[model samples]
Target chain A: MTNEIARPLFATALRLTRNRDDAEDLVQEALYRGFRSLSTFRKGSRFRAWMFRILHNVFINRVRRQQLAPRATDPADLAPSDHDHPIPDLRDIRELPEVADRHFDERVKAAVDSLPDAFRVPMVLFSLGALSYQEIADALEIPIGTVMSRLHRARRHLRTELADYAREHGLAPDPHAPEGAGS
Target chain B: MKCVEFRAQLFPYLDGELDEAATGTAAAHVADCADCAGRTAFERALEKRLQTALLADVGALDSVALVAAARRSPPLDSPTPASAVSSGVSSSSTGTSSSTRTGRPGHVLRFLTARRLLAVAAALLIAVQAAWFFCIPPFECSYLQAVERTVDAEGTPLRPGVVGPPLAERIEVTPEVLGYRLEGEATVVDLGLGETANSAVRARYAQNGEVVHVVWSDMGGAEPSFRRKREFDGRSWWVATENGHNLVAWMCPVTESLCTLVSELPEERLLDVADKLRAAER
Candidate 1:
């Protein structure tokens, strides 16, 4: 029973947190919560969706807590350091063909990570979880149309990101290629 | 259909959810229109790459500890918040109910204490029962214990007898060490996305010399609980009767494989053949 969610839960958490240790912790915490709340789950309900919902809820709560926490700041923290003059941007590095080739996957992953949860959650669930739009809507408690629209928007964003990467490598048609339109 | 319409339907058509006529029409349009063809190809390539990147990055999952953690906890429903029950009771009672509602915080504290006691009791009960189940040795564990149930047979011929058509042009097997022989091309079956195991590989060889059903996946596959007995190579294999049909499933940690061999042959022969097939590659 628990085995069915072990890898997927971890993988989903990993994607959400982008850290292996954090992912494992998130998965374990969600599993414990899901186990406790098992009775609340309707019979014949999708266990995957339920488990994922718990996982997503836990993730969102953690994010909220982190956001609400007050950070202790020293006066020096407000001051800019000479060593922090400027970090080279990945977009700048991506202009080189070999750099783009080596970094495209990372760039795509970073792009995915950068998406706001509204678009990221549904997109990841569809692509990685193999969930249908209805299932995604159920899991996220959103309207089916919202799920579809978010997926469309998310895919478009991913394509644009990949297209930019391709352009960097001279693999795309044009740098100014029109962003394809969809619902 | 216009190229715009065709492009709009590309996702559904690629997903194979389009009506047959629409699919045919879309295919015809793509055949004639280079732009649509390019877009469709790009979408397909993107999906493929996304899948590859996702799976490749899943990394290692420690399943045993996860299963143990799940097995330890009792269902959380018994400890419903006192406020909920009291609120329901108050709703049915008189004006004095308002006073009772005011006491909810205290009621909740008491309830929490009681719930803690109940949880401890339940945990103790669970431990005793779990020990008994394990002592018996042939308990029906959850279906998840049987993971990774298919072979990656891309370009590999499944049927030993049939020479013409092959099973699958693309094979994605989990655990990566499963093998089987099919009796005929007709034995190959379509695997729907819903039916396949998560992050696992599965294929049905409806016919070989004898029918061989194999499913190989990681521990992250879902199914209902069934009678199962653990077995060889530090994994659990179940040979149980489901709906009056004999089903044999194996989860081998040694080789990271889960295989199910189904046959009309007697149990002894079936086990023998399974053993041979399991040991074939290793």
Candidate 2:
């Protein structure tokens, strides 16, 4: 079981925890619990996805005691009209230019790490850990709608960083892609 | 409205968590949009590179190393302060001394004095203890001894009833660094002889030069009792105690003969040995 699922589960987990040491710990812990509860995993479903769900759950529980940053940082000025506060940069991943191409996985980790723990974890589960919005909400004990909005914003943030990375790395916009868009 | 906005939603689109219709619209936009496409591919590559780095060079695991570490004492549960562990005093001092602070305000001078006092106290406590151990000859017996206190007249001795049989002969040593060891002695006694005796009889002995440090000891169960060893006679020499005298058979090889005085050892030595501590900072 370790051999089969180790790669996918760890790859996704590493994305969440960029530090190799922490990722190894997370993978070991997640896999150990996953095997213990293998009886709960129905065989036909995607093992990778199910394992990720478990990992995301394990990560959440491990961090429950950690006081997440008080929504102290600037909430994005471009608040979605429907929300109470300005939407947090759910996908501010693109602003993580140094992490882009340089150490993509590590950048994801750093970006995720910088995210107020509240949004980062849930967002990663939905985006990379491969949990559905409902799965994320259930695992995180948050409402599904919150999971959706955070994920949406996280991706936007990621795009911002990735674009800067492309520009700096001399990677042109997808050539057949667009012109003058660098503006 | 922008390439950045489209790329932000890309991961969610791939996750299929976006509402089906919104997912389709995002997919359609990315397919036609060069900038969004470029951003997604780059981010994906970055993510892949990170995964590879995390997986690489996990280091070869040696089972012997693991087992040896596991068999040693686990880490002590207290935090050691940095000041307590400082090593290598610099060769040159800045020539600063308490008297140098003569003109400073009283509070500042007192603070410096207090720090110097603390350093002196720690140095005396630890460094002095280490020095005392190597420099001083054994002034007192390594431990106190009660000779002839509880031994019986018959040569057969009773076993000390403590955590284990009172007098044990055991030595535990491992071949590697980062290891804990327990070494040295036990004697087996027939419990039938000691049915009425509340303690075990042992002769705790050490050899210094040609003289054997021996003490006739009658010990309560399981407690380690120390007795000055007896002098060695070239041949079999025996000394009498309140209990039956212990007989020592001398041989050319002294250490082996010292061990022959006692028989059976404790059933177990130590427990809960471990390693694998997390790297943490306070």
Candidate 3:
């Protein structure tokens, strides 16, 4: 029972945390917390989704804390360094978009990984879970406006990246490439 | 409105998030404006194409595992201030209510999955159970081979004793039921013996699967409690319990497909509980 619930959620954490050991540790902790607070959970709703959201929240908070931490000044007192450091910057994400399309799966996976958290999440929610913007807002605890803006930027970013991808790979024009008179 | 403003508000316009007045203006502008339509079409196309590149990549993300891990290392739990989990969401009645409301699924699964969850919860439950029946050895009952149930145990069944001890040099789990999975020169402490064996299985019987049943041995073998199936919810789940371990089996017919699935073996749960206890003890 727990395995079915934890496996997919664990997989999500692995993608987010990107450290296998950290991912495993995070999974264990989530189950402990989830079970401890089990009384608060609702019935008939999706358990995996609920817990997955919790795990995502937990991972995001850690990232935010690290981002907020004093880098050089606090290296001594800082959190343990992880092997899979997050792509905290937008520029880096834009550079690595799609990994040159050598392998379709690898290409796409790299593209998603390249996106910043703001864009990566709604993208995951909409693309992965098919959640609407409002639903995305609910899942991530962000406002409706923020959700819209992030999604908008994500689309634009993906378009800009994929356009370069098409040009470089000798692929056809992006179906999204601006048509006549739109620009 | 110019195409510029329309382009800026395209997503909101598509989602109809704009005010009623702005909505009217955007619609009027789009109908008369080919350029805006083209851009609108472009943005829409961008979203669609991105979706295609992205949708397949989405599930490729192991979301469940990630979330599960996140749940474990909650920054909120890391000796931080209480207000941390609420960092993004301001303290409000609505937000609190939503979080509280969202808590329902976990509760319900906890309730409905009572038996199965308990049976399979030990960290080693699946592994030990799998090991006990097919992967490892001893305590594997012959009766269980014919019975296959699709059951899952969530969480863990074992309480921690000691954790982080190295695995004994000769300690290993063998894949043979009715044979000691733990190899030679292993010090095993029985949890259910005398004072330690205070914990008991909480069984809720079902109406099905009463044809052939097994039970636990208590009351000096005359009153066997762990090795029997009790009636529950219009069915009888095969009940098998060891000293400190508990295993139950029940089958639910798939409405679309008619097939029977049985739960795990007798000592599987106990083995999980015991394995965890041992690991923690180490």
Q: What DockQ results do all the predictions give, each relative to the true complex?
A: 0.07, 0.03, 0.09
Model 1, position B221, has a per-residue lDDT of 24
**Which regions of candidate 1 are displaced past 4 Å?**
A1-5, A39-44, A66-102, A173-175, A178-183, B15-38, B64-282
Q: Higher-TM-score candidate among 2 and 3?
A: 3
Highest TM-score model number: 1
The whole-model lDDT of each prediction reads: 0.47, 0.38, 0.40
Per DockQ, what order, best first? 3, 1, 2
The better-scoring model by DockQ among 1 and 3 is 3
* Per-prediction backbone clash count: 14, 48, 81
- TM-scores, one per candidate: 0.47, 0.37, 0.37
Error of 2 at A2 (Å): 4.5
True contacts kept of each: 0.10, 0.03, 0.14
Evaluate residue B81 in candidate 2 and report its C-alpha lDDT on the 0 to 100 scale: 21
Please give, for residues B33-111, the per-residue lDDT of candidate 2 as tens digits. Answer: 8766665565555444433433332222233322222222111122122221122111111111112212333434434
i-RMSD of all predictions:
14.6, 22.0, 15.7
Q: Which candidate is the best by DockQ?
A: 3
